[model samples]
Target: MEERHVIVTYRLDHATIHELCAQLEPDLMSAIRHPTGIPPLLQVLSVLHFLASGSFQTTVAIASGMSQPMFSNVLSRVLSALLKHIRSYIVFPQVGDLPAVKGDFDALGHIPNIIGAIDGTHVALVPPSRSEQVYRNRKSYHSMNVQMVCLADQYISHVNAKFPGSVHDAYILRNSSIPYVMGQLQRHRVWLIGGSLYYSPKKVFQIIVACCMLDNLALCRQVPFLQEDGPAGGLVASVEPLDSEEEEVEEEDIDNGNNVIQQYFQ
Candidate 1:
């Protein structure tokens, strides 16, 4: 395949994709090969294409030399394969790691000790017949509420995708392991920020892990995202708050949070 086509379709170059596939191949390889079986490389490639394109299954499936049913299963398979390797890629900063992360972020916004920026998004899904209401988001579509924590360089440091679409972002943040992981004292500090090809809750989470892993790798490789204008631009966009009151932080906490911001700015 031509380099340009591969880059456009997969959003990763051949060498990087090869490196990713190498790590995933052992888990992806079958015990015994069947004539119809997909290779690990093709499995990863097909899934990457679907994620990069965000097109329907049949379209990508057909292009990948598999049926739609096979594509969904393969999507889950390749994504799940990366779950074991996630910590190696998307890691939360420990005390020793905090200074560098804090430095990068502090330079960007002139806020000291801000280790991460957190945000939430909804991953759309086909409404299921069972307990379907929980999956419908405020926008009235089936989805999963996915939370992410990002560093200034755009590496995804953490992810929480266990909640349903109806759940609020702040609720997911409150209920997430981050508070426990970071210690109660650090909860007020550090903060957040993929792809896909699937809708099952388990698969959705895996997709987040896998895509973030690739995104981190791509960031390391200096692979610009489709929308990123050029070298002088950034791997991540600054988070812009929405006008919706639903997105607002608790009124009681705003005063304290503002104080923190003010203290840093001053």
Candidate 2:
């Protein structure tokens, strides 16, 4: 495929996709070594197509020359493999490293001590077999309430994907590790600013993490899902925000009606 086609179809450039293939190849080889099995690259591409297009399994699987059932198994294996290496990509800035991060944020908007921006978005999820009500956001669709923190250049630094959409944003923030990390500040000026907030199943968690890792990887590689090409060799923007205006949910201040922000600062 040409460069444009590849980016549109897979949301990744060739080099990035090849690097991903390399990373996942070892784990995928055992299945591919079988006579009737699909190649790892094909498996990965199929999943990417499904993700990028939101197409039915039949469409993607047929395009990849596999049955829907087989493709489902492939998707599971690929997602599991990717999740195993999730920690490498979705790293938060270290306590000692906060100064540099703050500097970048300051440069961007003269917002001193602003280490990152935080926001929540709901990613559409398959209806779970159990406790389906909690996954349904006010928009009336099942989703995972994913909290993301982005650095100055829009690279994702931290992701909390364990909450369901029905949970309050304040509740997720209270329960997230960010508050503990903030507690240890004890006078540090670093801040992560945004809006939003699952009890998702194990497989659901893996899928969310894997997607976040991929988003970070694309950002690091200067890949953009946008149709227009960026300046030659210039840094590309981060993945497009998953939350749209239609999907935007008004955040509820769940801390006994007190200002959650003031509570954090005080």
- The candidate that wins on lDDT is 1
Q: If candidate 2 were superposed on the true structure by all CA atoms, what would the RMSD be?
A: 15.4
Off by over 4 Å in 1: 31-36, 184-198, 226-266
Q: Where's the lowest-lDDT run of ten residues in candidate 1?
A: 240-249
Per-residue alpha-carbon lDDT of candidate 2 for residues 87-174, written as tens digits (9 for 90 to 100): 7888888888888899998889888888789998886665567778998898997778878789988778778888887887888889
Task: For candidate 1, list the clashing residue pairs, or say none.
Answer: 116-191, 117-191, 117-192, 118-191, 118-192, 149-192, 150-192, 150-193
Q: For every model shown, what is its TM-score relative to the native structure?
A: 0.75, 0.75
Compared with the true structure, all predictions reach lDDT values of 0.69, 0.69
lDDT of 1 by residue, 55-164 (tens): 67666766766656666667767777878787788787787777788889888988777778888888765445787999989999778998998888888888888788
**Clashes per prediction?**
8, 3
Clashing pairs in 2: 118-193, 163-198, 164-198
Shift of residue 240 alpha carbon in model 1, Å? 31
